[model samples]
Target: MAGTNLQTPILQVDHLSMKFGGLVAIGDLSFTAPRGEITALIGPNGAGKTTVFNCITGFYKPTEGMITMTRASGEKFLLERMPDFQITAKAKVARTFQNIRLFSGMTVLENLLVAQHNALMRASGFTVLGLLGLGGYKDASRASIEKAVYWLEKADLMDRADDPAGDLSYGAQRRLEIARAMCTGPELLCLDEPAAGLNPKESLALNELLLGIRRDSGTSILLIEHDMAVVMEISDHVVVLEYGRKISDGSPASVRSDPKVIAAYLGVDDEEVGDVLVEVGDTSVIEELDGVAPVAQGPAETSSMFEGPIADTVEEAGGETIVPASPAASKAAQVEAETAAKSPVEPKGPAQ
Candidate 1:
């Protein structure tokens, strides 16, 4: 196999679009994973992060666009045109899913060994030489074991090498999945939500493992992650998505401070949006955002925005009205009161 190109990006997704019937899952998405760096794809829920992964990994054929994987010798493979297995075998791409997909019944070491199946089969000449334990089969099997052991140590799974994969803890299972992908000797590794469901400690450990993979093995990683801690700490580049379109793409610090990125994640209520927009230097949008103010149409509309009996209070207080400092303040107070009323209170008694 030829070595990968260090100068060019390992993966280039250009104008990629995936649509299921009338629903567009990803639209005209484009990004690159540079060689020997960790690039993160981040977004709010239903942002088509995983859909992008599926398109890259060949799980879903994109509706329109090109996915090109370039290697060190300057060989370019059109990933969109290849079968999923070909993408892995010929293109040297490996990926782990958002959910762990391991042979649970198999021992930890066996799972890693399975990743080398194709190589071993060729070395065995379709298992004929292996059945007789002759030729290069012995050497290939030994090398496979050594490779598995190497990843086991890297993943901190040496202690559980003989244990069943299903018995490992959730975090351990996550590591094992990555380790298995690494055993395939991928030039480009695509990881979907690798840090999902991890504790602080586990997240930190995962960060280290990913950094080590780039530093030592020279594998370029493209990851989809919601954990900002993981994304900000290790990613060399970050691409953000919203409603199937690219919203922000830059360094972790830049993306973190971007107004669009912040607003997307905030999911802020109408009253709080102006403040957020102001803070993010989006003053132009503040007036537009605040312009959608609720009008007091009727008693139901008034009651929906405000809690308690305002008229009764005013009547009982000798017709004296307490006025807010400003329209924004008044709106803020109304939203706060309405939110408090809508929040679910904990039950004091046991179940019936």
Candidate 2:
């Protein structure tokens, strides 16, 4: 048998399992994130998405399996064996949180400089030589400041560098968080809901920033996002999870049309499969012709706007709140609705 190529996935999760007493947050999960690509892990609330993030980032050790990451310079790290700092220092995997976690009291530039603390410490040799002004700590500090400034420019936060982090707008704060993560010089960047709260312009800015990171830095990204436009526009690959298990994994197009994925997001049972197929097929065709392929394109892509009985069912059963549509999201939904109305539909037939 031909073995799967492992030249080294930027991040490889193999049979990873995590439990909190009786609750199995992640169960036998496995996947690979290719280098220089954006891979999105998305699921409804309480699908154990954040739990998996914590495990990979060293907030919790896995109950089983391996999490491996290969650096640009050919260094391979067993992420589970390393502490959080080693995960950052050795594996070079950096992350942002679901909620913005900036040093609210600190200046924007200061928040970024703190991320390079380890590098600065090492450059100082942890010795009195630095205290005696013999070491190059001063120069190292200057270099760190330069790196922070570079990222601030990339995030478009250079103008606000001297402002308190808390003083920036919601979207600015989100970008600042990403800049701070990049300051760590990670090979793999993990973002948990970077677009959780932002206007359309801000979200688009984020999309551009992420694309720039991929294009210029060759950095691979793993993100958990509920924003359909952001996910559809930027992600090269997508993974859908429900109830702590993998439901679908593929390109955005493939996963969107997956029946299992549709049902998972809609919280419908197998018995209602025919109805969903009928509805999705009808709406999708209409949406396609109306030039709103973005909405009719996939289930997970459009379910964010659903607030009917199906949405309620998902909330009750999945034990997670349905992420509400942001103002930008409503525009996307309006476009989808128009598409559904204008596109033609086909008669429903038995599942092929």
TM of each candidate vs. truth: 0.78, 0.74
lDDT string for model 1 (222-327, tens) is 9999888898899999999865777788898898888767766635677566456445543222222122333332232221112112221111124343433222
Report clashes for each candidate as comma-separated counts.
Answer: 3, 1
Question: Where is model 2 more than 4 Å wrong at Cα?
Answer: 1-7, 125-132, 266-274, 277-352
Q: Cα-based RMSD of the predictions, in order?
A: 12.0, 12.5
Q: Which model scores highest in TM-score? A: 1
Against the hidden true structure, what lDDT does model 2 obtain?
0.77
Clashes of 2: 1
Q: Candidate 2, residue 135: CA error in Å? A: 2.4
**What is the C-alpha local distance difference test score of each model?**
0.80, 0.77
Residue by residue across 156-207, what tens digits does model 2's lDDT show?
9999999999999999999999999999888899999999988999999999
lDDT of 1: 0.80
